[model samples]
Target: MFPTLDIQQPRPFDLVGSTILIAGNAAGFEGTLSITVSEGHDEVTGIASVGSLGLRQFQASIYIPDATAFQLTRIFVTIADDTGNENGPSVVIPVLFGPRILAGYSGWQPYTVRAGDTLTGIAQSQYGNADFQPIADANQNTLANPDLIFPGQILRIPRNDI
Candidate 1:
């Protein structure tokens, strides 16, 4: 007898044309498992299966495509024995989409603070614009003095005009 299948992570993940990696584990009796993902009122988009050698654990990697911030509604994982008999339990995971910043602008560009690299200088070099305030804000005011940045402190460079 198996326990149940659970789909974890990516709860309400922002799906706007992005690939989301859904990962999780299972327990209690396993031979082979089939996984499926659907969007917007039970529309199946992807399916996959994993082979188990009498093991009680399973993991799956599912890629979702053409998803929007509003299309995803629910996710489900079904487990079955090698005889195609329904297993102990199946799991349904709810999905949500978060606010997307913008295309090609992840807002987490890394910057190594150099000997004298001011926020303004870094911004100018990275974004071709010398607007340091956005950088400071993005880094959570760690660049308050703009001239007090130390060596090896990573800063997130926000996309200009965003």
Candidate 2:
């Protein structure tokens, strides 16, 4: 039997656009590692070899096409140990679409950064402006650097998409 695997990247309902890194840990098995990111009719596999960390753990950084992020889609990750000698279940994550989910606020939306999040992404993607100058201004205090954003950090999205 395969030991339970823990996925550490692309949390559930995570938004996808640029190259997304898929990472996770699996122990007790040793040999090779294989990873796949699939959504609906499209799927991409690793052409390059997967690198092992220590023990049975491994990591792989993959790229999902930009077109996949244009609309709402379920992103799933699949891992195979030792070249499909055994495999783990795929869960819906790195999901596409939806600028941001309203966090029960009257005029603002709470957006937690997922795998790929940026001030420019919020502005252009959620608000439809690539410049995202308004977003930078809106989050002036926390958004000191427009180019860097990490998962789990909450950002208040202007209700007016400011």
Candidate 3:
């Protein structure tokens, strides 16, 4: 019996907003699978259903109602079988939570860096007032040095309503 799960969306170390769209392939039972997003303390869980066939595509939109409860910015997304085995076949993805950076945010806009671009300049152009911390925080996986951004490098500009 095929018993493997693969997450194709929101790759590892990605930044997720309040609601995340998780899509992947499940090679196992047609029953439901457990999808959990946890930050070591608080967690959100959902169930995804696989196709009747042994191997099928599955998608689930999980909403983190209380985003403020998580202490750590990094969260884990795990998909496992319904057998409740502690060591069963599962896929765990570690991603940065975005709401912690930009309050009430659900997504980001992509900005391509130019030759004469700086985090401060980008912040002024994107967010006004030159507060680049939010931009840097939202793209921890991409930007290693806030001051050293290369041309053609894409950055995620977090959308903040609050």
Cα lDDT computed for each candidate against the true fold: 0.48, 0.53, 0.83
Residues 56-125 of candidate 1: C-alpha lDDT, one tens digit per residue: 3345455444334334333333333334455445555543221122234333556778887877788788
* Clash pairs detected, candidate 1: 12-96
- lDDT: which is higher, 1 or 2? 2
Per-model TM-score, in order, reads 0.39, 0.45, 0.88
Task: Look at candidate 2 and tell me the lDDT of residue 35.
Answer: 62
Judged by TM-score relative to the true structure, which candidate is superior, 1 or 2? Answer: 2
Model 2's TM-score against the true structure: 0.45
Cα lDDT tens digits, model 3, 51-71, are 645767888888888779688
Is candidate 2 or 3 superior in lDDT?
Answer: 3
Over the stretch 12-96, how does candidate 2's per-residue lDDT look in tens digits? Answer: 6444334666566654234444566665566776532333444344556766545433232345665555434444433335543
| Candidate 1 local Cα displacement, residue 96, angstroms | 1.4
RMSD of 3: 2.0
What TM-score does candidate 1 reach?
Answer: 0.39
Q: In model 2, which regions exceed 4 Å deviation? A: 1-4, 27-30, 47-57, 66-72, 85-94, 97-162
Superposition error at 86 for model 2 (Å): 6.7
